[model samples]
Target: MRRFDSAQPILAGLVSAVVGYASSFTVVLAGLRAVGATPAQAASGLLALCAGIAATAVFLALRFRMPISIAWSTPGAALLVATGHVQGGWPAAVGAFLVCAALIVVAGLSPWLGRAIAAIPRPIAGAMLAGVILSLCTAPVRAVVDVPALAIPVVLAWAVLTRFARQWAVPGALLAAVVAIAVRGVHLTGVSIAPAAVLTVPTFNLPALISIAVPLFLVTMAAQNVPGMAVMATYGYTPPLRGVLVTTGLASAFAAPFGGHALNLAAITAALTAGPDTHPDPRRRWVATAALGAGQLTLGLGAGLAMALVLLSPPVLVIAVAGLALLSALGASLASAVTDPSGREAAVVTFVVTASGTTILNIGPAFWGLVAGGLTALLLYRRTRPSSPPDPTPPSPAATELPSPTAAGPAASR
Candidate 1:
């Protein structure tokens, strides 16, 4: 009993890592591929991301003695898929990755830049995220129509497990996808399981920078890092913001040449390790994230195998799993995008433009969406502003008077 009790946090950490990795790896792979990474380069990117996430999680957890979970930016990956191929190919995308990492570092070092990011209106941010992921989120439905034999079982498994074991739903779906792929028989003749990294000489181009780097940075900061801090706060833990941003930024830089796009603080997975459910004593929760590091390291060793499986499997099946993984995020983003009546129009404009996936002047839709939303918000707000301040009238005695204790209701009496 004593041994099992001590192992709880460790087990929770492992579970968190597994859930985090299995949930959206396909999104990462698809994103890398869509941006022009070859199969080997994409596999390398996955490996690099796993390594960066593991190193960051373990170091932060131990150094801070807090459950500071780290993760690859999943929404950023979805944004990549939406952006599609860049002008300068994989190397240019890599340069964009480097630029994003530098921006993250600067955001940490410069208070003004951090504030600027925070100043990006929440509704616009949420709407942009929603739009970027809209198509990917619909891939499961498309998969059902295109490949029922492979897709149906995966969806059913995810749906059933979501009803009973919510955290395991995506992993279960991934497992089902693997089973379906194996049964369907895929050729894996020359695929290698040994982990390896492929270096690309990064080249900078205006198109890639505007199309990929800027939007990727925005999505990662808004969707992952900010929410990650909020999750820690919810668990009564104050993360080391400067340390986290700098460390993750540096790690992302290290992995960028190997094709990893970005790494950031984990939000959804952080809750698994940081919450009271992981350990009754809050102080012990850091052990869970430490264990998560180990789990990620172990998984990193198998990146080649994972990528091989993904490459060999039917494209629609893997895409369907990625779509299923993002459904919850999409729902949350949409809700947040339209939650405030004042910002609803701007948010809707952002969403429509982003979902359209149109490019103008070589820049992607995500950037244009923000521009449109920001302009709409400015116009609407300026038009609605009062010409003069309202008079500060005093309240009447009757209006200001408190209700009787009895009239206040039963709870008030108690």
Candidate 2:
């Protein structure tokens, strides 16, 4: 069952995984571009994100009998944008990662963050999500302005097609946008082939750890991992958290040598892989996620090809596809934000601050945006926010929920 024999979830996993992977490419690329990552930095970040996602999906699938794709929180990416443009190069960035990773590992291993996740009111989570999605949707809006001559007709067509024909929304909207905006004569150029060699050496440069390690870790946890787990919880899987963190960490440790950075739980992406839309049997979804892993290996085994595609692919294609893919999520988030009368103001604050991309000091707007929203909800709208009221201090369970040194985890299970 652990090996290739587990093929039941293949059909659903395939479709969702394809869409998930494609949409993620847009996210990683857009974030990297915003941070002004060098070609190598961009490549490294992408590889880390992809490899981290694939490996996590496989682990969660096998562990929980469901499809799980651990994805980076694009919100986290928003947080790290400033770091990329900061004074330090890759070395400093590495330091930042170590810090971030340590924080996450502690959160996962300890009961604090875990309890927080469980305690957070469902409505608040929904509001936070709305804020996050609203922040990302603005990408397309700005992209449209940046390239209006081409963007105008494309976006107009997307609106018309999606408005008039609901079922034909995503693919149709994307098709119209990409085709209309793309310049002709653009095609894949030949790439150099490199021998497939497994790399295990991560040039441990301690000096730069402050910069690289912290930012990566921060974004990974707050943005990527938290949401990954949330998505799983939203779907009601509920796997072990510690194991998921450790495994993703291991994946990151291994892949770091190959230019991968922080890997963590995938929230938004897992929904794609684990939904009924992915497969009927929860036990079979692993196949679809496994397929995603294979794709990552392909990209790794063909690094030059990966880099070339990143370079050659039209920016318009990325924006158009990404915008359409995120459209549904954005709508869902926005709806959730305002659904509760009490949370309306807080949610609006989240949407505006986040969408503004304004930073507080060096911290990215996403983090501050969340902090701002949470505080406001607590202070101003305390009456409305569901009272988690200190866990009714019940007698402790006779035995902890652990196997005798065994039994184990997912952001996928969030």
TM of each candidate vs. truth: 0.93, 0.67
lDDT per residue as tens, model 2, 125-196: 444444544545555677676766555665676677668954344545445554553454445545433423
Q: What Cα-based lDDT does every candidate model obtain?
A: 0.90, 0.55
CA shift of 315, model 2, Å: 4.9
- Quick one: best TM-score, which candidate? 1
Residue 206 error, candidate 2, Å: 15
What is the lDDT for 247 in model 2?
74
Quote model 1's TM-score.
Answer: 0.93
Worst 10 residues of 1 by lDDT: 405-414
Error of 1 at 59 (Å): 0.8
